[model samples]
Target chain A: MTAPQDNPQPKLGIIAGGGALPARLASAAQTAGRAVFVIKLDGHADDPALDEYPNVSTRLGAAAKILDAMRANECRDVVLAGKVARPSFSAIRPDWRAAKLFMKVGMKALGDDGLLRLVGEELEREGFRLVGAHDILTDLAVSEGVLGAIAPDDQAISDARRGLSVARILGQADVGQGCVVQQGLVLALEAIEGTDEMVRRSAKYRREGVGGVLVKASKPQQDKRLDLPAIGLTTIEEAHLAGLRGIALLAGGTMIIDRAAVIARADALGIFVLGLGDEDGETNHGV
Target chain B: MTAPQDNPQPKLGIIAGGGALPARLASAAQTAGRAVFVIKLDGHADDPALDEYPNVSTRLGAAAKILDAMRANECRDVVLAGKVARPSFSAIRPDWRAAKLFMKVGMKALGDDGLLRLVGEELEREGFRLVGAHDILTDLAVSEGVLGAIAPDDQAISDARRGLSVARILGQADVGQGCVVQQGLVLALEAIEGTDEMVRRSAKYRREGVGGVLVKASKPQQDKRLDLPAIGLTTIEEAHLAGLRGIALLAGGTMIIDRAAVIARADALGIFVLGLGDEDGETNHGV
Candidate 1:
C-alpha cells in the first residue's frame, strides 16, 4: 500500500446499501472535489451513478475483497449508507472469507447493529479508523433548526418532541430510527419494515389536528462513519403520504443525504424540520 | 386520599388481561390470605378453573364500576395483570369513562404504549396506587438463574446475550420488549405485530444448531408498578413453534405470569429459562 500524498479533499469509499443515499452521498462527495469509490453492496447497491465516480468498484459480499480494495486504492475513510434489510439475511451467500467470519457467529449476529459492529470491528483490526459520514461531508450533516417553510404550531412541536424521544429510544434499542407520534400517542415505530412502512401505518390511525412527528436519530452505539440516519426526497414524500407535519432529528449527528433536494421536497410538502439539540432544547422524553 | 391502614391481607384489584397469570395470581394471593377483585379482560383473560376461586368476583370493561367495587371492598392496591391488548385504535368502543378521557387526545396518541401511559397517569390521578402484578405474589416471579433441565448451547447462549442487550436497549427506547437472535444475527424484533409474530419470523431462518434466543424485557424507563413485561403458556408455545432454545428475561425486574405453569410448559418443551442479571452475561465460547 502506498503512503499516499495528502489531498485536501479525501476520497470517500461508499459501502452502499440499497436506496438513494449512496447515489446522494456520491454526488455530495463529488461536489466536495473528492474522488468517490463505490464498492456497491450485492443486490442492494447497483446504483446507476456508480459509473460517475472517479474509481467505481464492485464486490459480491466478500469482506476480504472489500477491505483489500479500500486499502489498495488508498481510501482511508468509509461510510456505510442506506438500508440493509433483515430479510436479506436468508438471501446472503457469503464468499469463502465471509463464510469463515460467518461461521464464527450465529444468526443473531445478522441484525443491523450486530453486523455493523462486526464490520466496524473488522475494519479497525485492519488499521482503518472509521469516521462519521458527516465528518467528510459536512453539508450532508443535517443542520440544527428548521429547514422547510412551514413552522409547526405548538401542538405539532410538542408531538414532534415526544415522537423524537420515542424514535431516538428505538434507535438506542437497535429496533429502529423512526416513530410517528402525535398528541402523546405512537401510531407506528419502524421495525423490520423500516421507516417508510412505519410512516404508512400512521395513515390508518385516522390523523387529527397537526398529524404526527417523524423523529430519527443515530443508534446509541452505532458505528457512525458507516451509517448516519439520512433523509432525502423520498422520505419527505413518504412523510406526506403518512399525513405527518414535521420532522425532528439529532442535530449535527444524523446526515441529510441531499440537503438542498430534501429541503426542497420538505418545502413542497409543507413539512417542518427541526434539528433537535441535546441541551437547552425542548426534550423528547424516552420510555 | 385517605391514609391507608396497614392491612397485610388487603383485597387486591386485578385488571386481568389474557393469560394464566390472573388465575395463578388469584390462587397465590388467596394462599397469602387476600381476596382478589378481578376485572377479567374479555377475549384475552383466560377462562380460569371456576372451582379454584369460587368467591372471586369480576367485571367486564366498566372501569368505573370495577373501581367502585374495589373501593367499597377496601381493596387499596390495584394490580393490572395479564395481556388484554390495548383497545384497538380503529374499532374500540371505549366505555363512557375511557371515551371521555380518550377524547382529550388525538388518534395519533393512541398507540399501545401511549394509551397505557395515559391510563396509568389517569389512574394515578384518580387515587389508585398501581403496584406490580407480583406485588403480593412474588413466588410467581421466575427464579433468577438458569432454569429448566436443559441449558442453552454455546451458540444459543451468544445469541441470548445479544438478544438481552438489544431487548434492554429497545426497552430504554420504550419500544416493544421481545427480540429474536440466532447465531449472532437478529432475526426479528418485536414491533406492532408483537412477540408471537416475531418468533414466527425467526422460525423462517431456523437451522439445526442455529437455535435462536428470544428475549423479552421491560423498557428501562417503564413504570414497573404497572404494565410489566409478562409471558405465559403462549410464549413457551411460540418458542417451540419458532424453534427457539433459550429464553432470556430480566432477572427480578420482569414478571412471569403463572410462573409455575409457564415453567412446566417450558420444561416440557426443553426451552432454557434464564433470569439474566441487570448486566448482560457472557456466552459459552462454543458448543
Candidate 2:
C-alpha cells in the first residue's frame, strides 16, 4: 500500500473490459510517467486506442496467459476496468488456473461482487497490487454539488432520496446499481437489466408533474476496486428521453466518464446532475 | 359481519372499476338469490354486461351521487373490485363530498393502500359493510397445491423463493405485488408499471438455463378487503413469452380470475401454476 512517490512505481497492468474508461485510465497512467501494459479481454475490450499501449488481447478464461503476460511486463500494479457481463459457466472454457480458482470459490463465485472479490484475492495472492480506477483517474470521481447549471427541485430531491434507499438495498443484495422514483412512488427497480434499459422501461410509468430521478450508489459493503457505480453521456441522454428530472450519484464513489461533455449535455437538457455526499454525516451539499 | 345464511342478506352494492371481476361477482350474487346494485365508475367500468342489473354509471369524484344511488337501490354490503389506475389529483374533479373526504384523508390518500383504507372507512361510516372480493368468490382464492400438469423444477422453485423474499420486502414498503427471479438472481420487480410490464421487462435479462419464475403475494400487512393480488390468462401468456418456467401466488391471499381457463392455458403451455402457503411452518406441498 506504499504510495508510488515512496518507491519506484511498478508498471500498471490494465486488465481492460468494455467502455472508454479503460483507455482513459491507460492514458492517465502513461501521463503520470508510469509505463502501462493492457490485457484487453478478447471480445469485450473493443477500443482500438488500446492498441497504442504495450498490450496483449486475451480471453477472460485464459488466466494463465494473463498472469504470465503481466509478470513478463513487470506490471505489479493492476487496475481492472470497464463493463464485463458475467460470462455463463457454459460459455467460459477456463484454463487450469481459472478452473482451479473456480473450484476454490465454488458456487459463491456466481454473484457479481463475490466473483470480483475472489478474483481480486487471486490477483493479490499472485503478488500484484490492485489499484482502483478512481485512484488513477481522480478527476472522474464525482464531487459533492450539482455539476451542471440546474439543481434538482424539491420534488426531484425527494425522489432521489427514495431511489437511493432502494438502490442501497438492492446493492446490499448484490442485485443492482440504480432505480427510478417519481412523485413519491417507485417507478422501476433495476436488477439484471442494466441502467439504460431500466430508465427506458420507467418512461411508461412516468406520472405527471416533476419527472422521476435516477439514483445510483455504491453497495454499503462494496469493494471499491471492482465496480464503482459509473455514468456517462448515454446516461444523460437516456434520462432526458425517459422524462426524468435528473441523475444522482454517490460522491467520491461514482465515476463520471467525460464529465465536461456530460455537464454540457445536462445543462442543455436542463437535467440536474447531483453528487450525494456520504450517508452518515450531513455536511456538504443539500442532497 | 353476520353470515348471509344467519340473516336476510342486504342488497349487495358493487363499486365496480374496470375488468371482468365486477360482472362475474354480480352474476354469482344473483345466482345466490341476492339483489345487487352496480355503481360503475364512469370512463373506467366499460363492461356492458353490468347493464343487465340495477346500476348507475357515476364519476369517481361524484361521491354524493354514488352513495345516494346505492342507498336508493337499498344496497348495504359493498365489494370493490377490478383494476383502477389511481387518477392524478388534477384529473379528478371531486364534488364537495368527495373533496371533504380527500381533506379528511389528506396527503395519506396519495398511496394506493392508504387511499383504499380511508375510502373504506368513509363507506363504513355511511353504514355499508365492506366485503372482500375473495369472500364472495371463494373458488377464485388460490389453494395450496400445484395446478396444471407441469410442476416447477428445482431451479424454478429456488428462483421463486428468492423472488418471494424480495417481494415481501417491497410489500413491507407498500411498493409492489410481484417480482421475477432467475437462478437465484432477481430480474425485475413490479412497481407502478404493474406485473405485466415487469414480466415483459424481465424477458431481456433472461439467462441461458431453466427460465425465471414470477412470484406474487399480498403485502405482508395488506388489507385483503381492498386489493388482493390476482392473476389471469394474461399472466400465463406473459410468463410464457418472458421465458419463465412457472407462476407462484401466495395461497389464499391471491385471486385467480377464470381459474379453470387459467389452469387449462397453463397446462397447454406446460407452465407450472403453484400456490405458496403462508410463510411459517413447512408447506403442505413443496414450494
Task: Give the TM-score of chain B in candidate 1.
Answer: 0.82
The DockQ-derived docking category for candidate 2 is: acceptable
lDDT of 1 by residue, A1-287 (tens): 22334665566677877777777777766766666677877666756776666544454457778888888778877777767765344466677776776678655456656677677777777777676667766777766677777787887777667666666655655656777766555665665556676677666653454477787876666666767677767778988888888788877657777778788888888898878764422353453
With a 3 Å backbone cut-off (N, CA, C), the pairs that clash in candidate 2 are none
Candidate whose lDDT is highest: 2
On TM-score, the candidate that comes out on top is 2
What lDDT score is found at residue B126 in candidate 1?
78
For candidate 2, the per-residue lDDT at B137 reads: 80
Per-residue CA lDDT of candidate 2, range B175-253, in tens?
6788887766677878777789889988877777558899998887777888688899999999999989899888877
| Candidate 2 ranges with C-alpha deviation above 4 Å | A1-6, A100-108, A111-114, A125-127, A277-287, B1-6, B100-108, B111-114, B121-127, B278-287
lDDT of 2 by residue, A1-287 (tens): 22356556689999998889999999988787788999999778988999989899888888899999999999999998987776656556789999999898674375445667777889999999999999898888999988899988877776677677667655655667788877666777777677888899888867776588998888777778876879999999999999998998888768899889999999999999998876722222111
Docking class of 1: acceptable
- Give each prediction's DockQ, rounded to 2 decimals: 0.25, 0.32
